[model samples]
Target: MTHRGAEPPDGTGFLAVRCDVTDSRQVDRAFEEAEAAHGPVTVLIANAGVTHDRLLPLMREEDFTSVVDTNLTGAFRVARRAARGMLRVGHGRIVLVSSTAALHGAAGQSNYAAAKAGLVGLARSLTREFGPRDITCNVVAPGLTDTDMARALTPEQQSELLRRTPAGRAAHPDEVAEAVAFLAGAGYVRGAVIPVDGGAGLGH
Candidate 1:
């Protein structure tokens, strides 16, 4: 998901380009197409991710690498390409979607957690390198959300999760989107980890 606009006179809306972050070629082409339609990408939301949860003893090496490649390295690939255009224009906003598990840890999601945590480092480095050029980078860490992903949990499981969350409920997807929008619109904020986790990751 990405946003690029300042509410046009008619408020038409944004363009949605499908790009496979795992494929560098596809990522490059997506940007080219978007640029042709709108202009250089001024805001990018690197939200491509996948989860492969398994206990460490049972986790296959392929599972770990695959998640990291798509979630962590995939963001790197897309961000690297997007930075080219942003640097040329001298302004941009980069918001990467991470997970609460990145900080709190999950029972069977070591790979996913590690990959998400990597985004924090990536955003910070980008902030340092691009901040001087009027670009900002940040992370949005979401907790359990009312999405297909959250539906995977059973009723009992969902209840258990809510019991632990201070909000006592799953977040609506729009709630997460709102945070991303705020970061995209903010110019002064840079390299910040803004968690929409319902206070689940307070200490971290």
Candidate 2:
């Protein structure tokens, strides 16, 4: 599902359903459409997020709430819906996409960091609640991925961050996706936060 209803490239066998994570009805409808076209959803990757960077003092209430609503609450909305189908099947996998900012706070990203950090707690709680039924939930925290978000950063900002990273480079998107794929297939790995940050968050 995507907010803009974007389709995968031809031959990918993906269905592009328009759904906004912020709306419960949209979440439900997307699942219904997916299930109708394919089957019950057994794996969910909650990756919807938006960033509104600002210092705490300069951030408005809306700024903080909007980020949280999309990043944290949005994951919650979709996960709740997906859990229904997983419960019926008695097994499933959930992977939450978090970020390194969650572990090592950024100077002007309190809202984004808080929301991403919340994902860890959410994954842990879901693991406990669903473990007995063979449902596993985990988080993958990626740092400075080579995505549009990273590209949006100024060159100097990117250079500064890479200098701090042990690898001195941003991660390929595939690297992060590989971690998610691993978690989805591993039955025993529950409530684990696997870092795919090129050692950027090694201590954390």
The prediction achieving the highest TM-score against the true structure is 2
Q: Distance from true position, residue 134, model 1, in Å?
A: 0.6
What is the lDDT, from 0 to 100, of the residue 192 in candidate 2? 95
lDDT of 2 by residue, 1-204 (tens): 454445445665577787888889988899999999878899999988788888889999999999999899999998999999999989899999999899898878999999999999999999988857889999999989998888887798788789888988999999999999999899999899999988887666
- Report model 1's TM-score to 2 decimal places: 0.90
Q: Over 4 Å off in model 1, which ranges?
A: 1-13, 154-157
Question: In terms of TM-score, how similar is model 2 to the real structure?
Answer: 0.95
Runs of candidate 2 with Cα error greater than 4 angstroms are 1-8
Which tens-of-lDDT digit does each residue in 18-112 have in candidate 1? 67778888888889989999888899888877887798999999999999999999999988988998999988999999998888888788999
lDDT of 1 at 17: 60
CA lDDT, every model vs. true structure: 0.86, 0.89
Ten residues in sequence with the least summed lDDT for candidate 2: 1-10
How many clashing pairs does model 1 include? 0
